[model samples]
Target: MCIKEGLRLHSPVAAISRETTQDFDLGDRIAPEGTMVIMNIWMYHHMEKIWGPDHMEFKPERFSKENIDKMDHFQYVPFSAGPRNCIGQNFATNEEKIVLSKLLRNFTFRLDPDHKS
Candidate 1:
C-alpha cells in the first residue's frame, strides 16, 4: 500500500506514448488512425475528480481492499496499463517489497538534530 501510494505521488515514468492502432474517438475530438497519443501519467495520478479532493496527499488506505474496488483500474498506472504495460512490473514490485523489508530490518533512520532547514 505504501509503495503503491509512493508510486502514485511520484511516478518514475513521466508519460507514455502510443500510436493509435485504429481511429480513436476522444469524446471532444477524433484522433485518426496511426496518430501518436501521449498520456501524462503524473497529471492523471493527481486528478482531484478520480482521486478525490485529497488527491495530492499521500494516503495509502485509498488502495485498501475496500476502497480499491471504487477506483478505475486505468486511473492509477504508475507502471502503465493494458496490453502494453510494463513487462517488468511484477518483478519490480516484488523487488521493491524485498528491498524495503531488508532495509527496515537492518537500519534505523532518524533526522539529524544538528541539521537546520
Candidate 2:
C-alpha cells in the first residue's frame, strides 16, 4: 500500500531543488538548461490548487486508491521522490508501524485534565 496517511500528515523533507537538463518553457516562464529550480514541499503540500481548499486538513482518505492515481507525482512527496527517497524508507515505515501498533495495544492514553501539551 502507498504511504498515503503517514506522508500527508508528517512529511520527511522541507524542500528539494534541481537544475534543468535542457531549455524548456514552463507555461509563462523560460527555464534554461542547467537552471536551478526548487520545490517548496511545505507550501505545495498546503496549497489549495494542488491539494484543494482544505489542504492543511489531515484527511488521509484523500489518498484513497480511487484518488491516488489521479494526483501528479509532483505533489505530496514526503520522503523525497524518484531515485533520491530515503534509502531506508521501508525499514523506517515498518518500525514506526510496529511501535504504533504496540502503543495502541498496550496503553490507555488520557489527556491531562489540568495540563496543556
Candidate 3:
C-alpha cells in the first residue's frame, strides 16, 4: 500500500509523449494522425476528482484492499500504461521496499531543527 501510494505521489516518469498511430477523438478534442500526445502524469496524480481532496497527502492506507478497489486502475499509474509502460516497474518497486526496510530498521529520522512545518 505504501509503495503504491508513494508511486502515485512521486511517479518516476512524470510525463510521457506518444505519437498518435491514427486520428482519434478525445471527447472535446480531436487529434489528427501523427499528432504528438503528451500525458502529464503528475497532474493526474494530484487531481482531486480522481484521488479525492487529500490527493496531495501521503496516505498509504488509500491503497489498502478495502479502498483500492474503489479506484480506477489507471488513476495511480506511476509506470505510465499500455504497451509502453516501464519494463522495470516491478524490479524498481521491490528495490524500493527492500531499501526502505533496511533504512527503517537501521536508522531513525526526524525533522530538521530549523525546518518549519
lDDT of 3 by residue, 1-117 (tens): 888888889889989899999988999998999999998999989999988898899999998998888877677789988888999989998899999999999999987999866
- Top-scoring candidate (TM-score): 3
For candidate 3, give the lDDT of residue 19. Answer: 93
Better of 1 and 2 by lDDT: 1
The residue-level lDDT of candidate 2 at 83 comes to 82
What are the runs in model 2 whose C-alpha is more than 4 Å off?
1-3, 110-117
- Say which prediction, candidate 1 or candidate 3, comes out ahead on TM-score: 3
Could you give candidate 1's per-residue lDDT for residues 73-95 as a string of tens digits? 78889988998899999999999
lDDT of 3: 0.89
lDDT (C-alpha, whole model) for all candidates: 0.92, 0.78, 0.89
Compared with the true structure, model 2 gives a TM-score of 0.77
lDDT of 3 at 116: 69
Best first by lDDT, ranked: 1, 3, 2
lDDT of 2: 0.78
**Superposition error at 86 for model 2 (Å):** 2.6
The residue pairs found clashing in candidate 1 are none
TM-score against native, each model? 0.87, 0.77, 0.88
